[model samples]
Target: MHVLLTGASGVVGRFVLKRLLDDGCRVTILGRRPVEGFETGFCAYDLADLDPQLPPADALVHCALVHAPGKFRGGEGDDPEQFTRLNVDGTRRLFEAACKAGCRAIVFLSSRAVYGDHRRGETFSEADVPTPDTLYGDVKLAGEQALEGLCGPGLNGIVLRATGVYGVSPGLADHKWSGLFKEFAAGVPIEPRKATEVHGEDLAAAVALVLKKTGVLGAPFQVYNVSDLLLDRQELLALYATEAGLSFDGPAASAATPGEMMTDRLRALGWVPGGRDRLKTFVHSLARRGGAGT
Candidate 1:
């Protein structure tokens, strides 16, 4: 299959790009900059200007997001209007362009943030209504709605409401927990933090699954939850510290409300994510890579 992938230079997008390539699919990246050492193809366009016709593609995996550097939850920075214009409107335009350009499948990478923090300590499923509290969640929800409205009849749309993604990416100096690990290495008193996280490789695998089973996706618009481990900073640091032979202090556990999502829908369709084993391997890799910033 010929796949057109966006945000190919991003931390998460890099994983999807690599996974698509590994699956023997022809990929053309649509981004602002050329991906180093990548020989497939590259197309340039501003996120605010996704008005051009795309190259021929069988699938469009949209991972591109316009946000402030080093953030996604508060990515709007100080420009919420611009954020809405870029993310919400930008997403709608991109999907329409892809469908018009003859792409059969459009996979949107939505966020678990769309569910908000109000459901403290709650588990979410596709059946649960999304109650977005922040602008970020609202934008993502709006983007999913746009896909639902525009995709049908010869176009397959799938939304993967992903949780926090972790893992090393190509051409990046830092992983998601670089700060946390650095703090631990420096003996900075850590605060207890917890959330749902998935390895980048496993998240990529979820995307690949839906791409292959586009026909069996049932509805014209399908939504699936993608997540793996319920990680707590206290436990994660303990694991890392053990592997690094360092001492981690503070961050006493509390009655923190845990957030979880149901991936049974994706699992039933043969999508299996790397579980606790992968989490351990990831920590081990971090320890091996000097533990400070790897």
Candidate 2:
């Protein structure tokens, strides 16, 4: 299968590309910049001006967009416009182009952000209506809509409403572990909410599982919330503090706050995360970089 993946240079895209390649699929990548060491074909294209002639692919993984830890707070207005241009408009164009080019499956990397940052106990299901609070969430929701509209019921369009995904990848280090490692290594007080997390490898594996199933078709749009373990700020601080040989400040919140995701759907498909050992690797790697806590 010739799979066309956007954002092949991104944190998640790298894993997705690697997983597809491992499964013996010929993958083509489209992105703003070139990725290193990938022998597969790559095309640089602006998301705003997607051309159908770029490549012939069996499936298209739409992963390119502007997203960051705190980007939503600062780029609310400007970000939404740019996000809509890329995520919404770009998705529409690519879905159309792929369908025309005989592509039948499109897995869009959506977000739990589409449901807002409400601290509720409700486990958000795929059946729940989206109520985005931030512009980032709104644009992602719009992108989902665009893809759904363009593909209709003939293509398999799955939306993975992923939580905070963490893993080790070169040229990308600004993740949950990076911050904590910096703070702990520097002997600074580390405070991190013991929130839900998904390893990049596991996330890639989930995509691989979805791709393996040929029976699922026609914009099936599976919205699964992926996350493995949960921790609070204080507990994580204590653990990392002990690891870094430092003392931790008390936690900010006491409640066992429900994290931003649910993995029941992914679990039903026989998916399970590799757990915090992956994060420990990242934390140690960051520590080797000289900063304990950043």
- Tens-digit lDDT track of model 2 for 1-294: 888898788788888888888899988888777787776777777677857566767888887776554454344444556666766677788778878868778888888877777755556777778888777788779878877676455677777777777776434546546666565546665444556677888888888877776345323665677676665666656666666666666557655565356677778878877777766665565555655433
Q: Candidate 2: lDDT of 220?
A: 64
Off by over 4 Å in 1: none
lDDT of all predictions: 0.87, 0.71
Stretches of candidate 2 off by over 4 Å are: 50-52, 67-79, 152-154, 170-175, 190-194, 217-219, 247-260, 277-294
**Which 10 residues in a row give candidate 1 its minimum summed lDDT?**
250-259
Q: Which model scores highest in lDDT? A: 1
Q: Write the residue-wise lDDT of candidate 1 on 1-294 in tens digits.
A: 999998889988999988898899999988787789666787776668858678878989999999999889899999999999998888888888888778999999999989997787889999889999989899989999999997668988999999999988866778988988887788787877788899999999999889999987788899999999988788888888898898668477656866799999999999888898998998898788776555
Candidate 1 lDDT score relative to the true structure: 0.87
